[model samples]
Target: MQVETLVVVPVVLVAFVFYLTHNQTGLPRVGKSGPFGFILTALKSITSFADLLDEGLNKYGSKAFVVPTMAGSLIVAGPENVDLFKSSDDTAINQPISVDESLQLMHTLNSRQLALPFQAVVVRTDVTRAISAFIPEILEETRLAMAEAFALPFGEKSTTLPLFHTMTHLVARISNRAILGPSICRQEQYLHDIIRFAETLSIYGQLLTWFPRILRSPVYFLLSSAFGGPKEPARAIIPHLKMLLAEREQGLENAKTITDFLINLAPPEEIADVKLLAMRVLSVNFGSIHTSSIFGTHALFHLATLSESELDTIRHEIIEALESEGGYNKASLAKMRILDSTLREVGRFYALGVVCLNRVLIKPASLVDGIVVPSGYNITIPLKPIHFDENVYPEPYKFDCFRFSKLRASDHTDLKYGFTTVEKDFVPFGLGKHACPGRFFASMELKIMLSHLLLNYDLSLPGGAKEAPKPIFFNSHVIPDTKACVILKPRVGQAGQDL
Candidate 1:
């Protein structure tokens, strides 16, 4: 009798699932043949995400096509349906759902405790107004990383280091200084744990997202347990966090950082719980570290591959800006046009992913040309062509470092194109009301780090400038060559070793 009951339950679940999927309406189906063919094609698409998107673009670049999923079909489109994202309201097209689905944060983050106070911190402190005061400290941190962490030669001797691993440490130190205070940031143990914890988040976070809807709950439970039981990142960093939160609780703290902001973001009733506080820090680290390292590493590779003439231009720009601005102020960092433009080019070619502005339709959406998108559909903008199409950018395949700077020089141009400048076509940060709010501060960090690298080190790729290292794409990320190495030598008049 028990065996017969289990068989009946399984058959019922299958029938219910099939009926539910079949009833999903409005989305134009993609792929050949019927439902069986789509199941096979969708399975293939899971392995080769980029190739699948490219195939879809070739067939339906201008219109929305449904990518069949177990839950139903998802609405995926290229430039033609970009308005579906840009012009849609957050109420109709949900941004939080898209981010939550892609990153699997809801499994780890508490609904009550997940308010983002860091954006408040960034806007209040690190944007144009308060970041000026942080310039010297940032410059100091970069130089400290170069000398102690990097240990570049004081004299003629230098070292060959793996680009991704080395840049990870450098960025960890810099970002930690800004997020946590210098005392915690400088600790060897905290640095190792936080960096490793962020890396683990990337590895495990993506694994959780691979499961289909039917298996999501069970698969998530399995992987989440293996990933140190949801409080893993917090558990790893909480030792450092506890001491500081205790300090603040006792009113013994004089300085404030993102930790203070996290406390502020917490609900008043539960703000004192150090465990919840650590969770907030975990969220910030999870978002910042991976993206920061990706852009930093890619820009470093390009900097390593630059010609002597280009290097001279970068060096000259840095020197002139620093000298004119009376040192490396926020204004000085802002004025490094050559350095900023180079990083922009790197961002364009190697963004965090090939897709952006993803939204899940909560309320039904109506588009122009009599198209209606039913609720419960996921829509995404394929950013590959918007970034690289020849029609948008002439000679798009070539790497022109001064691409935006040249554009800024046009006769009627009023605004200079910095890395943070977001236009319709130029959105490495993202698009719309929910676009990356921390871009200004991120640019400052990247520019300062890159500026110090150019000013202090003679850089090179492993084989030669000719051998271009390829970026690896999996799911949504464009991962730079983690295994590639760069040779470095300290400049003659550098002042960072003793710091």
Candidate 2:
């Protein structure tokens, strides 16, 4: 009976998956469609996602198509359907649901707080509005954090370190200083545990997708046991979060940190839920730390590849801005137009993924040309192709750091060309209503870090590499080269204190 049951279950699952794969969707399906065709396609997506996207675009121009993966089939929408993202009906088209599905968040996160809107609400409203006020602390944290991480002595000697790992630490510390305040953000153990939690959640999220839906729960349980789970790290923040909550209740704390905003804005019933609040903080940390660190590393790599004259041009801009504004503030950072352009160009050159505006339809929807897409389908836009479209951006293949800066100067449109600007062609931060809420804070943070690095040290790729390290693609995700090294040499006799 046991042997018969084992064989029967295997056959049943294969048949069920095969039936689902063959179900009619009435869309042009890309790649093979055999019983195991989805598996092959899934592998291709991990190894050559760009090639797969190009193939879909070439075969089915400006129309929706299906691309199968381990998670499920995705409806790859073309540029013509970009307006689908502008819809205001959250019930019909949900971004959070899409995130939960793609990241397996329901299982990986193991927390109900993710379903709540407290984090997004606070970030979009409080954190963003309070950025100007947080700039000084953020800048100071960036300075101290960088000095400690790089430790390039007080001479001409250079220091080499793993760019991605180092950037992750710096971002985590600086961002936490604003979120948790100085009291808890600098705690080495707390930062380490939270960082580990974020990594564990992401790793397990992807790993969970490798199993059939029926087997995922069992696999997750075993995996959690084998490789300590997100819980261990998540629990590490609770004690500290509890203290903050107590302090606020006792009138010993002010409404300054991100945690305070969350507590103030959270629904009345969940206001004092310590575990939920910790999860909310972890979620924020994951998004801000991962995205900012990856972006900063990319920008620094680009800086390393530029000519000495180009580097000087950026350095001069920073110095001029600091001098004119009398210090590093929001206005001074804004005046560093070249630096902003470089950061924007880095985003364009290497986006976090090959697709964006990911959404899961809750009800049947119609896109451009009146094409109807049924419910329960995952939809995403071809982000990389639109970014490289020559029709929108002249010479899209070249890495011109001055691309947007020149546009800002020639066209006299400052805001349109800024790093945080989101359009159909530039959707690194997504588009329309559901765009990343923390973008305002992230823009200021990246600008400050890049400017500080430019002013304090000369950056370069080790071994005189002409180009930045090539980005690694896992499925549609674009990961910066984690093993690449950047040599940082302190500028001789140049004081870093002024800026």
Candidate 3:
């Protein structure tokens, strides 16, 4: 009886899933069809999603296809239909809903964050507008961070540092210097909590997706850091945030940080809530620290492989830009066209994911050829494939640091190829109105830090390796080699040129 019960239960569940998925979409599928196929595809999605996308595009051409995942089916639209992804009809296709569904934010994070995105709004407005004013702060923090993270001996000696870890540390400190302020940003405990929270949220969010939706909230509540099952660093930072909020109420006016902007932009009723404000800060840190550090590491790794003369070419551009503009301000950074191209090229090469512009349809939407996508289906653009399209980028796989700079030189009148420019083809920061609002700030921050590194130090792969370690790809994320090390030596005869 017991053996029969076990076999029957397995059969029943598979049959039920098969029933639910049958005829769910009219679009072509990238993998085998049916419940058993779904299981296989879901496993492949976790391990080799990019391969799955490549197979889909190769098989279906420019037509849309579905890729199954643990979360749900993703309707991947090809390059030809990218404009449909730029639709502003929030009621039909919504990016926030897609994010919430993808990350399971309603359970893992505070649902209020999804509903009230005051932090993002502040980033889109206050952060971008204040970039020029905070240039000195960013550069100072970059200098201090580099000195501390890579404290090598002067002349004929070098220190090897873990690339991703050091970049994260540098970005966290420098970004928080702009996000919170100088004193709090430097606090060891506070910085630890912020980094821990971002990591915890990412891990737990993906973990929770494997469970049934009905059990997710209960599972999260039971195992969350508040209950001592998992680490919730957001809770750890509440007191520090409350104190900051109190200081704000007591007339501590700081117009330069996100804290001030949140207070300025948030509704009066939500302003004094410590948990709300703490979560907001955590969200901002997660977005800034994780993504910036990843791409920063990518750019540095590519730079590490370059010949000394190639490095000098970029260094010379930075020095000229600084001299031409008299300082490290917005205008000066803008003049560093090669620096911008280097960063942009790294993005185009080591993209963040296999797809972008993910949206969840709340209502039925029709596309070309009278194909109607049913409500609640997830949609994504094939970003990685588009980035590597031979028709779009010549020698797309090569790490040509001057790719965009050469493009700009040809046109001379077009800013479309700039680092911050977003189009259908090049979309590391995403595309359209819902694109990353903090890109202007991120671009400035990354450029400043990279410029500082170029001027003050020389970087090479440890042990004289010709290339940096290969980046790791898991599920959809393209992460820089987290454990890779780079040798850093003080640049000779470049003391006064440091940012």
Error of 1 at 342 (Å): 1.8
Global lDDT of each model?
A: 0.69, 0.80, 0.79
User: For residues 75-126, what per-residue lDDT tens digits would candidate 3 score against the true structure?
Assistant: 8876765677775567887888877776677876678778888788898988
Error in Å for residue 495 of model 3 = 6.1
Candidate 1 runs further than 4 Å off: 1-32, 68-72, 78-84, 113-129, 152-156, 212-218, 224-232, 236-242, 411-416, 493-499
User: Clash pairs of candidate 2?
Assistant: 46-475
Query: What lDDT score goes with residue 278 in model 1?
Result: 74
What is candidate 1's CA lDDT for residue 150? 59
Listed in order, each prediction's TM-score against the native is 0.86, 0.93, 0.92
Residue 345, candidate 3: C-alpha displacement in angstroms? 1.2
Question: Candidate 3: where is the Cα deviation over 4 Å?
Answer: 1-23, 153-156, 221-223, 226-237, 495-499
Top candidate by lDDT: 2
Query: How should the candidates be ordered by TM-score, best one leading?
Result: 2, 3, 1
Clash-forming residue pairs, model 3: none
Q: Comparing candidate 2 with candidate 3, which one achieves the higher lDDT?
A: 2
Error of 2 at 175 (Å): 0.6
